[model samples]
Target: MTAAVFGHDGPWTEEEYLALGETQQRVELFDGSLHVTPAPTPRHQRISRKLGNVLEAAAEAVRLELLEAVNVRLRPGRVPIPDLVITEQVDLDELIIEADAVRLVCEIISPSNAATDKVLKMHYYAAAGIEWYLLVEQETLTMHLYQRQGAHYVERSVTKAGAALELTEPVRATIRPEELLG
Candidate 1:
């Protein structure tokens, strides 16, 4: 069973952390523990920002919205601040806080979260019914797209800079990995 997050306006219910707001740390709550991550290196930010920019441009062209650095509150007591998260926030005005409304969640992995992104968090997002989860590695400029199936996720594509990502459900648009990695 999942526990409700106790105390404060931040993210988690089991514990407390203000490093993301106090310092430059890009932290998250993984299974109720405070995972303090280092400030994103230039390469990390480059990839994240590039991807956000690309999605933002596409959203504008399509008259939708793509968000970045949004703290998502998943029910299993996990609150992750993803690098480039895409949810249509135009008419919604604010995050629903407790639903599977987010269309996609993308993470540009740092050294600390390579396995966490690919393995652990996969179950978290999949269980929450998030439609898609994408993983990006800045060092090699690779993209891994996972779409949720019945109860698990099947890897849709493991792409490189030359490949294009196709968004199928909420929108059908193709974006080159190079444009997202910069």
Candidate 2:
């Protein structure tokens, strides 16, 4: 979740959180507590879209699919939405993408919630056994590709703007960071 889960009464169950349907705000559960935030900025949306487009072709060529802003259920109580996700094809009707079914989970950093993207969510993704986690820093136009090594993510590459990122795990894709900032 983007915001802290304190100053409230108690933690809310997953079912309780979902029942408060579609508030148009971004909502996630961290430590069984509800955290909500406003929608992303225009720059964030643009970057996410451009990055997804670059990854989409590679995903399609490999018979995988690219999904944007989809709920990824890491486990029973935690469901976080990443800006982009690449996964093996599954039925379209599935509500939340299971952690195992996901090959790669990507998050585009928002300035207001950078830690949640870089550290907090990264730990959760690694703990869920997610194989790949791609973190994009919008401010610097840098992408850090992390591969799951044993129980944690090991930094595989750090590509800067105008540089190309070559990925061999989770999927094969060459991404140019500059294209995402445009």
The number of the candidate with the highest TM-score is 2
Question: What is candidate 2's CA lDDT for residue 114?
Answer: 93
lDDT of 2 by residue, 55-148 (tens): 8988898999899877788989898888889999977777688888789999988888898998899999999998999999888889999999
Q: Estimate candidate 2's alpha-carbon lDDT, on a 0 to 1 scale.
A: 0.84
Clashing pairs in 1: 5-13, 6-13
Across 55-143, the per-residue lDDT of candidate 1 in tens digits comes to: 77766665656777656777655777777666655444443233365777888877877887777777888888888888887777788
Name the candidate that leads on lDDT: 2
lDDT of each: 0.69, 0.84
With candidate 2 superimposed using the best TM-score fit, by how many Å does residue 145's alpha carbon deviate from the native?
0.3
Error of 1 at 168 (Å): 3.2
The TM-score, computed over Cα atoms with residue i paired to residue i, of candidate 1 is 0.78
**Clashing pairs for predicted structure model 2, backbone only:** none
